[model samples]
Each structure stands twice: as structure tokens, then as C-alpha cells.
Target: MVTRTARHGSDDESGDADYGHLQLTALDGWRGFVAEMHTAPNLLPTAVWTGLAEDKRDYYDDDRIDHHSRLLVVQTPTIRQVIASGRRLVQLNRNAHSGRCGLMVSGPAGTGKTTALTQLGKTVEVIHRRRHPHAADDIPLVYITIAPAATPKMIAMEFARFFDLPISRRANITDIADAVCGVSRDARVTLVAVDELHNLNTRTRTRAGADASDTLKYFSERTPATCTYAGTSLERTGLLSGTRGEQIAGRFEHGPHRSVQPGPTMDRAHRRLGRQSATTPAPAWITARARPLPAQAHPRK
Candidate 1:
């Protein structure tokens, strides 16, 4: 069974602490985990809202999103391909006997890899609910963003957190893996979106020959849920090199177009600004100057 500590909040507040705020602590812990190979107090947030205002902005700007939906955006073609691959996995989920499938989307920053996967997640959730109404309790999509400073232990902890599982530094890796697998198995989460996968690159410094690739391979081979990687194309290629590439490609091949409209087009900008200007209050002088020019100097008749 998974146990999670309740987030501390003022009694005056009506709601629980936002999950995004907790992610900062989780991310900090991930960084410490990489260096120390153990969980530490550094994972706790100094201030809950420190870096999250921007995330809120990004969250709102996501396309095809509604209050109940969670969306992420990606701009790169490779990342888009990975999201497409995730869709294919969900398709295969209809054939449960086929086992698990993994999808890799790699690319550089500002390429919109995360954004693409987010849009894909929304689609998967809707499809899964439609296909398996009986399993409505299950989260159709689980989106996990890898912190840049993440460690294997931190990764495990994040998974535990996501499923509301109890986690301590003393927990065993195999146990953590089992717990994660169990959650996916039970929840029927058709797809797992892992963004910023390159964070696992630190594992390369270890003598065990582990790297982000190894971590990717572990998730690919272990979890029943379809895994999708969202990163730069260059990063994706690097991640796919060697044995792991084969595993990723074998499980999921590329599929059809799943693109969303890119954010904030120039036309949209003009419309928004024009509307704002029209409604905004004007200075008394400006308002008086614009007083219909004395009814068009009587020219209109």
C-alpha cells in the first residue's frame, strides 16, 4: 500500500497545497539523490510558489485544454513523433495480450517536445475513458516530468509520489519498481509521458555503466504502461543509441499526425490587442479630442 504525507497548509486555507508546488521539492530531492544516492531534506520547498508562476502560465497556454484536462506542449518534429508513438501504444492497449509498448520522442529545448506529449496525453485520456468506461477510476494518462537534477532514487520517489505511495530513502529499487508497475497495472494508465528524459544523463558518471539510457531501458522493459519520451531530437537519438534504441523502436513505430496549432499566432495577437485597446479607458483629453469631431463638421448631413 502507498502512503503519502499530507502537505502542510494553514488552517485558514480551504484547499490542499497545489501539486505543482510540491514538484519543486521533488525536483530538489531528485538533484540530491543523483549526487548522494539517497533522499534528503533539500527536496522540501523553501517557498511553495518560487518557480511555479511560470508553470501556471504554461499550463494555461496549452492548447485543447479544459479545466479538467492536463496538457503539455512540444515543438519538435521528433517529439511529435514520440507522442504519435504513444498514441499507437494506446491503440495496442486494446489488444492487452500484446504486452507493453514504449515510445521515444527526442529533441532540443524550445522544440516543444513536452507540449506535444501533453496534447497527446489529453487525447489518450479521452479515448481510454471512451473505450473502458468501467475503469473510470483509473487515470488514463500519467505525465511525469524528469527534473534536470534527478537521480534514480529520486525518480522512484517521484513515481511513488504520483501514485500516492509511501516512499523513504530506505526503500529498495526493486520494491519501488514493483509498486510503480502495480499502480500502472491497476490504474490502466494507457500511457506514461516522461518529459526532460535527458536528466538521467548523470547516471553515466557511475561505475555501474548506468546512464539515462539504462533508466529508459528499465522503464521500457518493466512497466506495463506505454512509456513516451519527450525531449530534443538530438537528445532522443542519443537516448536511443545502443541497445535501448532497439527496445524503443521495437515496441512502438511512428504513426499519424497529431499536431496542435502552435501558440499565439500573429493574427491572434492583433485581435487580442485590438479588443483590449477598444475597451481600455482613455484620458479625459484624449476622450474629449475624439468627441466625434463635432459630428464630422456637419459634412455627414
Candidate 2:
């Protein structure tokens, strides 16, 4: 939410009226545009507030949102790190430059780790496609969510599905990996996001998680795309355990410890991440910070 001070006309307008007017004015420039990291574009119409009673309308139209939640992505320190890492990855992938670049985003469940990646993927897709409009088969960004109890085969199948390929479940992991990597290289997919990475650790006292991590490591090593692994405390999972984990960790442009937190302290952190140069050829990383809603403001389920 944006806060603005407005001058109320001495004539019938009270402070509340002036505030509402100010808010509506702010929405004028923002309408129809999705803020960075936000899931949906702002569709609020300013004209609706012209002659309506204050209590007659909601500031945000929930009906405008589809089944998916439209919560905005706040670019706290963690998000900035993710964006910077993605930019660096894209740079490395340009002109077939080989680099085992990756990024791991880990935090508590409600810390917006998935949300950050989702928006980042969307942003990267748009920017990359716009820059290379004539390049067909150039799938700049592909996102794959790790399912519960997902195996390496299952994960490889997910990739095949994402690419709309018809691969049987009985296919060998090596074959699946090769097909996916070949397609990724041909398609020029610059970034690949694997969400809920912690799910690999579901089977404890076994090497299942390690094997899953190995698949990811192999994929990262083979492909030119930047791999992003995100989940709840993903760094603490088996994905980051032992010697192999050390090798994977070294590929990250940013450390796993960085994460977004709520409140004024977070605001201070955002200010310190340094602004991106406008003249730089890289995509402009958005730096909007979302304000926290009051405890009672959430709508009841």
C-alpha cells in the first residue's frame, strides 16, 4: 500500500476525502501494470471511486484475481540476491559460454521463497524473449516444481513434460537427462527453477536425496542454463549435505543464508543492496517493497 499526504480543500472535503483522492490518483499510473514480483497486474479502476460511498467499495478488487493468488513479490535482500544471480547466469549462458552457475533460495515456509522464483522466472522470460524475438525454440526460462516423494526418474519426467515431449516412464534416467539437456541447449533456456527442493529429503536414512541432488548436479553441469533450487531451509537438507553439496554450493553466485524478512529492518536491507544502473544492458531488477498488512486485515478463508 502506498501512503501519501494530500491537502484537503477547505470547502466540503475532509482529510479522509483528500486521502482517498490521493490514493486513487496513485492508482491512475499503476493500473493495468503488474508491479515487479507481483503475480498479477493491478486492475483497479480509478473511475469507480468517483461517486461511490467510502464503504461501498474495496480498495482492491478480489474478483479481478483468478484462482491464483495475486500477492506482490517484495524484493527484500534475498530476492535481490536471486535477481542478481539470475542476471549473472544469463550473462554466462550467452553465446554458449560454459559455466556451472546456480542459485539456491532457502528460508522458512512463509518467507516467499517460491514466490520470488516464480516472479523472477516470469521476468526473465519476458525480458529474454523481447531481446531475442526472432529466435525460435529459445525457451529462456523453465520452472519445475518438485513433487512429494519425487525420484530422479520422476524429476526427469517432469522436465520432459515441461518441454511437451512424449517420454515413457520406463525410460532410463540417463536417456531422459540427455534428452532434456539437449533440448535445453537447443532452446537456449537460460534459467531453470526447481521449487520445493527439500522434498528430496523425505526418505531419511537413505541416499535418495543425495541421488536426487546428483541428478541436479549433473543437469547443472551439462546445461548452459542457471539452476535455482528453492525450498524451506533447503540449505539444511540433504541436497546440501557432504562433499557433493560443497561442490554445488561453490556454483552459487549468492550464499544460501540470504532471505527476505518482514518490517522496517527489511527496508533498511533493501536500501543497502545498491541500485542497478539504468544504462546497463541487463534487465532492470525491480526493487519494490511490499508493506505488511495489519493482523486483522487478512480475509477469512
Best by lDDT: 2
Could you tell me which residue pairs clash in candidate 2? Answer: none
Can you give the lDDT of residue 239 in candidate 2? 58
Q: Distance (Å) between predicted and true CA of 224, model 2?
A: 1.6
Write down the TM-score for model 1: 0.54
- lDDT of candidate 2 over 91-137, digit per residue (tens): 77565555566777887777677767865776686677678868845
Instruction: Please provide, for model 1 over 1-301, each residue's C-alpha lDDT reduced to its tens digit, 9 standing for 90 to 100.
Output: 1222233233214464444432422433322222221111212142542455775434332311221142222234544445566677667765665447666555446645655676677567666667776874676666677766566666766667766677667878778878887877787766777776666553353322244446555765566567776655433334444565455556654332323333353245445555665788954322432336576578754
Model 1 lDDT, full chain set? 0.54
Off by over 4 Å in 1: 1-85, 93-100, 202-212, 235-237, 249-301
RMSD of each: 14.5, 12.6
lDDT score, candidate 2 = 0.63
Which segments of model 2 are wrong by more than 4 Å? 1-69, 93-99, 202-205, 254-301
